[model samples]
Target: MPKVSKHLNAANLIDQVCKCLDEIPDHRPNHCPNGIPFPNFAKSAFAMMHQKYDSLLTFDSDRADPVILHNLATMYHVQDQKVPCDTRMREVLDPIEPAQFRKPFKKLFSLIQRNKLLKAFEYQCGDLKDWYLMPVDGTGLFYSGKCRCQECCVKNKGKPNEAYYHNLLGGCIVHPDQKVVMPFAPEAIVQQDGDNKNDCEQNAIKRYLAHVKREHPHLKLVILLDGLFADNPTIELIKSYGWHFIIVAKDGNHKSLIEAMDALCDQEQLSYHKIIDEEQGTRHWFRFANDVPLNASKLTQNVNVLDYVETDSEGKRHTWCWVTDIELTKDTVEAVMRGGRCRWHIENQTFNTLKNQGYSLEHNYGHGKQHLATNLAYLTFLAFMVDQIQEMASPEFKKALKERARGVRTYLWKVITRVFLSWMLEGWDELFDALIYGIKPGRVQINTS
Candidate 1:
């Protein structure tokens, strides 16, 4: 254990976040031989996002304005220095392809794994009792009333009768102890002319699986999914990709399939039971069903099922279910239940954080007639990953955060606002000194020269 505490020391984490930005090719130079130094766009963006999440700042960049602002945030509070009024920020992001932005997501996964932040997932799924469990799902983030670009998914409305939607198929490896769910590259679901639309979730899953395998052939994962993905073809496809699955199996969705499972269970054919206690003050009773025929049709594959009933503090009884590729046993039921329940982490941890936390994922920062919407969303997610990593791994930054005592966004906004007021602070260290050493505002000279 790394002696976990509440105070967040996020500088090293900030450094890590900056490194992700470094992976991006900077066209601007530092001098004649090196050109002018590239502006710290990553830090500025992160700072802005952090403030936005804290509800302390807002900038109106309607026609690609350069200077960011805060109606309530003071000039002395500004952290990011203003750049020349060039449309370069938008131009720089405009041409960058979406595929190139996706590279950082993979880097995030590698960094978490290397730093042991993801160690909590060592064995939460039964199939890989020693490996991690990754569940894949898809979601749509941007939708527009106008036909934005060629890659847009079009839909017909009542009057205007036209719109564009952007969606991504996302996947994450989940574990009982991990607070943040690690997300993979999202496959865009778009539309095309003369075609019904672009790929749906089913096809997206197929391509995503292939991509994951091509990249991490030896990685161990047990895919968990909704009942929509419990069919034979999907199962076979998953198995072929060399991954395990724990999909939802509802009696209503698969009537014949559940009937077969019931018959087998009644015959005392390899069925078992177990009880579990969750950290969230919930109790779960699990009924394990294994090697049961998934379909009554000609094509059937034997799969494992775990039917669970949970009772929470409010005395609400919730019925849940899952089908897995792992064999059911007394030793594995607890792990199965954990993987099944952690499915909510993707929605709660990943998507919710992106929406409610500082990322403002749903907010329309830029709705370019081209790829601006999707590109901005990617940038926000990248910033979010950096924040989560800092919260989980960085110690010094965490401590400074604790002393600040406010939320991450609030503290960051104060820093940014202070910078804009032309305070004497040179770097984060001087800023921290001003905050801690009680250097009153306007009492010191900010050495911009």
Candidate 2:
């Protein structure tokens, strides 16, 4: 483990991100074309994502201000004398493959690892320590009736009513107690060439798993998944990468496996159970069976099955079950349960925050003829990753967040944008101080240089 910094800040992280963006090769042709620099256009798009602007029109309007222009140039490394309009931004960015945008995400992850920020994310299960819990799931980002792009997957509901939508498979490093979840590069669930079959979450997961393994081959990850991924092939794929998994094993899907486990429990062979009483008159019961085959066919591939239920005085019961490659024992059952439950953070913290909490992730920014919608989603997730990093480590960001009365992220974003436009601030620290200490910007010396 590296020595973690106590003062890691977002400004420096953004600056490093800009440097990484600078390294992406400009694939545009050199002939007579629009004069807007690719880096400037890319930076402008990234700025809109970071600010959580709902549309490109608003971002273009804000970019017209000379103060905002100066701030963009100074803060985000946009070099063009003029910001690219929305149309030109789409034109320039659409053709640039979404895979290129993934570089910055990898860069940010590397930075987090180097700074030892991942130490706080390390999850343990008895003898297992320092395992990063990566939860993978899929969600719909865009849906329209009339608008259908080449990338949109078509869903026909028997008649004239058809739906075209874009779905993505997203994974993030998550922890049960941690409020922030760091997202990885998402894989789009879109139509592919020469294939009549529509792309689904399972296919996307295969691609995403390959991508993750190719990108970070050495990182120790325990794959957390929902019931959809509790199958033989997916488990084999995970095992092939030398990774561990804790996947939801629902009764409806794994009936045979459940029956076999129940038989073992009835015989009290390879089965264990524990009961605990809480102060609030709640009784918690845990049961687990080891070396259970996943199905009738894959009898050689065994998994450890674990389940828990809590019954209150009112007779209400809450139950959960999971299957994992990890060995099931009395000492490790609770830790495994915690790891399994942390999968919700990917949906609640990452997806829900992006959708409802001011990121406007579901809003249609632009559906270009090519990869615009997917690229915009990628950029939005990148912005969310930066914010999560700041929340986890930066004291200045935490202080500014505390100063807000409502404590809503959207309001905080509005406050930051207001301060950026109204005040002659030079860096993030000065802007944060203005928000935190209520210091008038007029009193501070403005450093335009």
Candidate 3:
């Protein structure tokens, strides 16, 4: 069978993740005793996400089952007999900063890199095979009026509780050719330092960029963002980190940028190129101008503008413009435009999958007084990161994922949901085997009481 690294099998990868959870410093008071191990709460929360359980109540309900307890021990390294209940999970996980979960994302990434699954995300840039296409975007997790927290971003200025919401800045390594996008740790967007000023996506991007850079200093990336991030400060911040960016520059949002492009076109400085297919009845047009000022105010800092238009077989023309620091040529414009357009994958593939698929990211799992909502979001993404890596690297997992009418990812989780809730797994392999080959993976214990 085709394979990834011997260690990339989910069993070992999960062990590493469990270890990372174990290292999350317990925030409970030093004098506290007889409480559940902090890692058990973390692992139990992760298990709930991994199994696509409906809520903390659903996962907590089965904590007493010997089968559920055994599966937690075998699969998630929860040695504690006590799994944290719904309220307990949130209360314990609340004060813990969301950044603590980032190690698991990095751990999974290192393993994926070692296993060479990340090469799929790399695209050729001149003689270098180093550029990983990463798209950064913000998304709404959920909103609540009555369930407000200190970290919730209030949308309206009138009533403090009128429109409380939670948003996250999510970024991931992506390629146009792949369905699976490798996610980095996401940044939560909320009120900062208990301030009344609502945090915006722009501020979150600053924190997101700084944190990702600190975590992965050597990794080369081409960051993609929407029109909101196509600004002087954000671009300058990206450059300070020695990274490249392709940010969408819309006509209304960046009128100065469009004016600059128009001037370049009038001066005949903009290079134009096109690729057409008679067989498919499609046309792709590209225009690029280098060293254009970002805006009237920021004349000193310049960016490259690439305009793209595509005419489909149905004769519908779609167009877009992007500002980037990557040196643009007619030859490189199409590649850069494709990468720029990948910002949508942050919406369609990543966020949409998390919401529509079994991940249940927007579900108000439990919003605590502090970081409960944010920490749960990280665990959901962490589970998603591990699941995506397995989907790509594990032959066994791939087989299980494609079984019967369950080829859809949402369906696989359904199988896992049933297994996790009902099946008495002897080991992790039995679950995989049962999903793939339909053997009796486990049996429910007979009622003797």
Candidate 4:
């Protein structure tokens, strides 16, 4: 099998995705002579996601233009295409399984690994070295009192009213210092059967973890998780996969574990370390105990408990506590604390950017009876992954982003879309050149011949 190219740019990445979509078998009725090919419909939908169009109606309107049609053919590789109307596009995409979209994510990650882009993400601490930190969390994508499909999870609020919502368990590779996060495939927390039981985050997490391990069995992962995942079963699952973890442990939830650590500290059996940075007017205190039991029932499941408190010149203080399989030492405790705290990036960088920064993750694009909403979310995340890759690797994109005023991403997107629509460009390099250096190609003309 041929490897994905080491020198892939945004255009080449999209082209590779087009090839992957072309391979997904279209299950539309065979007798329908007018059915759009799945790849063309998928590519068009991805274009909307790539450009951050708010609605299918707006995307369909833009797709009606001859210039847009030509661009779709040349740039995205849509084939034999009359632009499908919004309704038709939804109908076509509804039945397609969302899992199929994960292929491109895996492929792109492989390319990054092969090209040595992942080296920058390797985290180093005390005795631990060269492990990638993957933070996992869940978020609500859609919520309503009225709209819902079969997949929506319903919550009855002890009244005549019910809240229907869609939730997704998202995980991302992160670093303590880097702002960019590379999201992995997300698992939908929804109704699996017609049963009364609604799916949940913990259940979704088990599925997500299994999927991640199955997909990348050999990748050295140090899983970072929140207080919700500090339970015995989840920790056991992480251990069973031969992966390391640093999970938030709160006194309220893990009282027994906290008490055990406190007892060890009173006996002076645990290690204590402190640092005061006079220049920054901050004091750091760390305490750690090894061979600590996680809970009453799981005494055999030993873990390392580490906690830190930081005090500033104003006398305000902040504290964090975590449980990890990795041993805590004087040299390694601070790095472990940083890794544990960086788990919030899954929310701040990945979910927030998707929801607030013009990706319109919560907007109701299409809610088909089957998989349309989930599929669209997957495609949108794929677009985000591409943008993140460019942010890390593309100097031209970096230059354009730096020159963008006020650092408003939506405005930058507008400029890029306008350039894409107005000019005839060969690839992403030309697009970035135009944005960075004010170079313009001749306006694209509709070929009437």
Give each model's whole-structure lDDT. Answer: 0.61, 0.82, 0.83, 0.82
Q: How accurate locally is residue 259 in candidate 3, as Cα lDDT from 0 to 100?
A: 88
Model 2 ranges with Cα > 4 A deviation = 1-7, 31-34, 157-159, 193-199, 275-282, 298-300, 312-315, 404-410, 441-449
Candidates 3 and 4 compared: the better one by TM-score is: 3
Q: Which is the winner by TM-score between candidate 2 and candidate 3? A: 3
The C-alpha stretches of model 4 lying farther than 4 A from their native spots are: 1-6, 31-35, 157-159, 193-199, 298-300, 403-410, 424-426, 439-449
Tens digit of lDDT per residue, candidate 4, span 347-434?
9999999998869888888998898889899888888888777667655566678885345556777898887776666667777777
The C-alpha TM-scores of every prediction are: 0.76, 0.91, 0.94, 0.91
Could you give the C-alpha RMSD of every candidate to the true structure, in order shown? 5.9, 3.6, 2.4, 3.6
lDDT of 1 by residue, 1-449 (tens): 33332222333444544555556666543524332223344334445554453221233231123223331112112223443122444545545566666666776667676666656667654346567777776666777786476667767734576777777666777677877566776666655322333336666677778877876777777787878778888899889877777788887778886787678777877455646455677776777766777878766888877787888877799987788888778878777777777777777788777776546777765555556556666767766666666556555335545666354644553554454334433345554555544555455445696
Query: Which portions of model 1 show Cα errors greater than 4 Å?
Result: 1-88, 124-129, 157-160, 192-199, 265-270, 276-283, 406-449
Tell me which of candidates 2 and 3 scores higher on lDDT.
Answer: 3
Error of 2 at 126 (Å): 2.1
Which stretches in model 3 have alpha-carbon errors above 4 Å? 1-3, 30-34, 193-199, 298-300, 440-446
The local lDDT score (0 to 100) that residue 172 gets in candidate 3 is 94
Q: Residue 72 in model 4: shift from native, Å?
A: 1.9
In angstroms, give how far residue 220 of model 1 lies from its true place.
2.0
